[model samples]
Target: MYTLNANEAKTKFGAMLMKVQSEPVEIIKNGSPVAVVVSLDEYNKIEQLKMELVKSRFENIDESDLVDGKTFREELNAGKYD
Candidate 1:
């Protein structure tokens, strides 16, 4: 990862964007880390990994563990997910 303070990132946005084509860039503000800039290819790979993980988990579930849509919605509205 490459690191840049907020001011540097703002002033050198084009350079930072170019750097991210090869590796991720870390952005900091007030001496604290705030964000990462990655190439679209990297971002898409991450999203694909997330989807695969979710699909694998769902595949492992038993039908008995499944909830109907209405019941799931009711539980969700009751803050069960929170």
Candidate 2:
């Protein structure tokens, strides 16, 4: 972990951001660790993992159960229940 004081972080914000692209950067305030910055690639990987988890929750659902008595427009318009 790379540590940077608040002032240094602010002054070199762009370079610090670039460093975070390779690994995490820790921001310290008053000698205490406050926050972390990570790359977008890492963030998106986490998001994709979350989506996969949500998708897994529906993995066992049958196609018939998913489409039961619902027209495409009715489903699209949120009127399927009626």
Candidate 3:
């Protein structure tokens, strides 16, 4: 990862775009971190990992613990979880 100030990033936008293809670049402004630039492939990989995490967490759910939408809404309105 590489850090670049706002002015440097603006002046070297093309180079920043190229560098992000190889590694993430952190943009900072006024000495505080602002944003991270990443390649499309890296972004997709991160999204895939997030999806896999969600799937793994839900895969072990028991059918008996499931509730219908209407029942859930009713319970929510009744403050059952409060």
What's the CA RMSD for each of the models? 1.9, 7.2, 3.6
Quickly count the clashes in candidate 2: 0
Residues 1-82 of candidate 2 have per-residue lDDT tens digits of: 8889888899999999899999988999999989888899988998999999999989888777665444766786886557
> lDDT ranking from best to worst?
1, 3, 2
The C-alpha lDDT values of all candidates are 0.97, 0.86, 0.96
Candidate numbers sorted by TM-score from highest down: 1, 3, 2
lDDT of 3: 0.96
* Model 3: how far residue 80 lies from native, Å: 13
| TM-score versus the correct structure, for each prediction | 0.81, 0.59, 0.76
**lDDT per residue, candidate 3, 5-82, as tens digits?**
999999999999999999999999999999999999999999999999999989999998799999999999999989
What is residue 63's positional error in candidate 3, in angstroms?
4.3
User: What is candidate 1's TM-score against the reference?
Assistant: 0.81
Candidate 1 Cα lDDT to native:
0.97
- Candidate 3 Cα outliers beyond 4 Å, as residue runs: 63-82
Superposition-based RMSD of candidate 1 using all C-alpha atoms, in angstroms: 1.9
Instruction: List candidate 2 segments past 4 Å from native.
Output: 57-82
